[model samples]
Target chain A: MDIILSNSSDQPFYQQIKSQIKQAILRGTLREGELLPSIRNLANELQVSVLTIRRVYSELESEGFISSHTGRGTFVSTIDSELIRESMRHLVEQDLQKVIQDAKAYDISQAEIIDMIRVLFEEDL
Target chain B: MSTVLTVKQLQKSFGSFELHDISFDIPKGCITGLIGVDGSGKSTLIKCLISLIRRDSGQVEFWGMSIDDAEQEIKNRVGLVMEGNNFYDNLTLHETKELIENAYPNWNEMIFQKYWGCRDYHYSSRTLLSSLSQKEKLIFSISLALAHNTDLLILDEPFCGFDPVDCSEILVMLREYIQDENHSILISSPSGMEISSIVDSFIMLDDGELVFHMDKDHLLESHMLIKGATSLLGNIPVSEFIKLDIGNYGFTGICNDYNKIKPYCADLDLTVERTNIADIMMAYMWRRGNVI
Candidate 1:
């Protein structure tokens, strides 16, 4: 797994790494049961504190995205299909929320917006 | 977290200068940066901890062994790299290496050899100590410390004379050294910006007293520099600021918890940015009219 960090970005280092890893896992770039780098190894690679990486690993573990075994190492968890579908729905909901807000500002009715979505969806297909 | 070294109510006095009731723990697998300006008793505190200078009162413990009772044993497991080069000038690097090797029973010749050739250092053991530049001497000192199987490394302003490239190399070396969860480091420096990126936590000292001891991430996340027109200051709780400076054109303040005043910043059109260790240090220094 590759992670890049930016000191100039507003997000803290830990958050950046955590989000990137989560995105990778969700996108299926990281497969289930795939081993993650050791905390020390990842910390060295990122030039971040070991504690920061530990926090990321612990949080990801708690969120059910990963799991750790003693004397072994961290690995991506086998996420439920429902969780993945829910996450995908959540992402669309966020984007659609913005689109609805924009449509409402333009005085577009809900039926009209639905019609436009249907037309665009069919065109893309 | 397990503590590698604990200093309890450590006190020392030198004429008008004194470190009053200094206390803190060096947690294992972490790099604790001791940040304070010059004359802040950083060196004095380090001396007392290393027993280079005796403390007036306090308990210094390493792995639960008091320094008073097991000074040699504790020293053996602790690596020290201070500012000055105490090795004899007449001695060649090889000669000094032999002396240090004989002193520590756990000394590893491989580690010593690896350090000199590590990164871009390319240091030779055949050079004379008197001929080495200040930067080279500092590197040599650190190399000596890491040569032993030490659990904790104590560095006092080790980057003072180093160039930026040299500093980064040393930082990487130190980071690699602490990969083992049992190892730790305590480093002292006048400038926080130099070590801010690598330190896990910061112990800030001002006028011989610890101003605050906090995790680096927590400090960075919470503290912010708020700037806006002087008139906008009236709309917010001015008392919440740790340090405030009012100017004719505008006002600038350091907020200990930016989240508390974040709403005001958004509503009042105040410019709020993440504050760094250097900014916090400057505000504290100027709080009492110190030009440092």
Candidate 2:
């Protein structure tokens, strides 16, 4: 599990960690039942406050991406296929939203964007 | 929330200098940074908290026990790491270790050996305290403190003389020490920016007075750095800002709360950026009109 944080990013540090871990779980890179690093260990590795790591872990647990056991430590949760598909779609929608905003700033029409997407999709196929 | 140490109306005076009604808590399992400029009474507060010097008034409790009531018990569990002047220069490391071992009954030889033998601090026991570098001495002091199984650490400007690399090494050791939820640290520094990332909260002092105690997340989130035309700031009340600098070219200022200033910025073109601890410190100082 690799997490890279950018200091210049507008996103808060805890939010950055939470999103990266969520993406890893959705992509199947972190398998279900895989024991995650201890919160303190992760905090030390990232050079962030232990409280920040605790917040990230608790938020992830609440969101159904992970769960913790009393002395056994935290582990990734078994995510359903439908949830994974939904999350993937959400991620794509976020990227598309950024592209749409940029296009509007440059005064590009929706039809032109659809045409460009069609060309790019066919080229990949 | 459980607190490791609690201070109430802690007051101390040295001739004309004084700490006025200083009070705060060191929460369990959190790193709290004491931020203040020179002569801000940070050192005096730490001294009073640890019972190094007598406080003129107020109550300080460590785990609910005052130093006068449980001096031995408190000394056993609390660690003190000052920048310099604690150790004897004429003694070898081995001799000093022996003295510390006798002072603290709970000292663990194994823990001391682990840190003393680590790659970053491979100082031999035969090395004299006077010959070791400042960083090495600091490492040794901290290692000894850890060996005694201290639950709370009070550090006074421990990062004063180190370069960035050496300073980070100290930070890494501190983070490792704080892994256990029972341990807590209260570190003081004039430069708050250096330790901003690791501190869970901040206790800011200005000229022997308590300025504010705030959580790190809220402190950084609520304040903002605004820069734009000086003419645009004419409408905004002066009381809204802690520091407002008006230059011939434009203006830059620090607002206490971004939400309150949002309405004023509707027609005024301004560049608003998130603030760091240093900027916040400067803003508070500028508000007090103490820029020295």
Candidate 3:
């Protein structure tokens, strides 16, 4: 999997790693059951400490993005459609709430906000 | 974690200088920083690690297998970038990458592109190493090292001669590489000011001998710069110090217990400052009379 880090960015190192792996999975760049480079190999390749890498892997594993087998190495987990849809729906709802809150704070009516969003979609199209 | 590299009683002598009784394990997936002065044998230890130079006496194991038995396999898994541009001057950046790619079994092109973009190394693959600027040369070398995707990256002064932007970019790349948990880095550089904060642990060498091997936090907490009048120096017990340097204004030393000495120093009206890695290294070297 391709990963990049930004030291100057506010994001922690592990989060950068997690997001990259997550993006790869979402983009289908990393296939289910594709074995990742071992933690030591990744650490050495990246010239970083193992502890940092271990934390990333543990985080990924805990999130069900990857699974590790004893002596076998880590692999991207099989995609669970239901889980993915549920997570995506939750995220969209949260984002929608933020949009509504922003609209209210700006003194924009719901109909105006909806009209603006429709115009944005038309521009994109 | 499995042991990637181990050295026991590793003794290497270069005329007057020798790395004595150096024993350490580079646990799998850990970045181990070898910190020392120019002549303190950091390079010698790295050379020994790669078997570029023969050691007088020592045992080395790579991946739990003896180095003697698995030299080729071990070398295959170990990526090394020493001081200077080790690549051929005539070869283009692309040529260098091709050469390394052919040698290593696990070279990854996608990761190479990502690191290249992250480092902002914009040279075309065909750009000759001879034509590149010094900073470009360093970035190219780093890219080639990461592209190979080795189990361990042994870098000597990887950040030398780069501007702040380039240095920061390289640090980001290094952090990303270690995120995979299978990689580890062993880097030695005289300019530890920038990268010390990110390093996991430090191994300090003095006069070709291992002086200190400890985590960064412990080193910062344990060592101190004790400043007091020259007369107060005699009153302070010598047993509390690991090494001491007496200056005209005051003295600085590596103390075993900072708390124990704090009260005595307070009574003596002396000032104490917590030591940083650089200061501790300087004082330690000064005590050893290695600094000139």
* Model 2 Cα lDDT, one tens digit per residue, B224-267: 77888887777776567888888999988888977778677645
Worst 10 residues of 2 chain B by lDDT: B116-125
What would you estimate as the lDDT of candidate 1?
0.84
Q: Candidate 3: which stretches are off by over 4 Å?
A: A1-125, B117-121, B229-235, B243-254, B262-270
Model 1 lDDT per residue over B1-292, tens place: 7888899999999899989999988888888999998998899989999799999999999998999999999998999987776789889878988899999999987877777645224546666788887766777788899888888999988888678887887787787787777888899889788888678888988888988888787787677788999988889998778789899999999988867888787669998777789888777777656653
Question: 1 or 3: which has the higher lDDT?
Answer: 1
lDDT of 3 by residue, B1-292 (tens): 6878888999987777888989988877666778887888888888887788988888999888887888888887777889986779998767877788898888888767776665445666677779877766776677778776678888897777677887777777677676666887888867366677567778888778888777554465556566677788778886788677678777766786676676786578876666567777876786777875
lDDT of all predictions, in order shown?
Answer: 0.84, 0.84, 0.76
Q: Could you arrange the candidates by DockQ from highest to lowest?
A: 1, 2, 3
Instruction: Pick the DockQ winner.
Output: 1
Model 1 reproduces a share of the real contacts of: 0.38
Provide the TM-score for each candidate, comma-separated: 0.89, 0.86, 0.66
CAPRI-style grade of the A/B interface in model 2: acceptable
Q: Candidate 2 — which residues are off by over 4 angstroms?
A: A92-125, B118-126, B231-240, B258-269
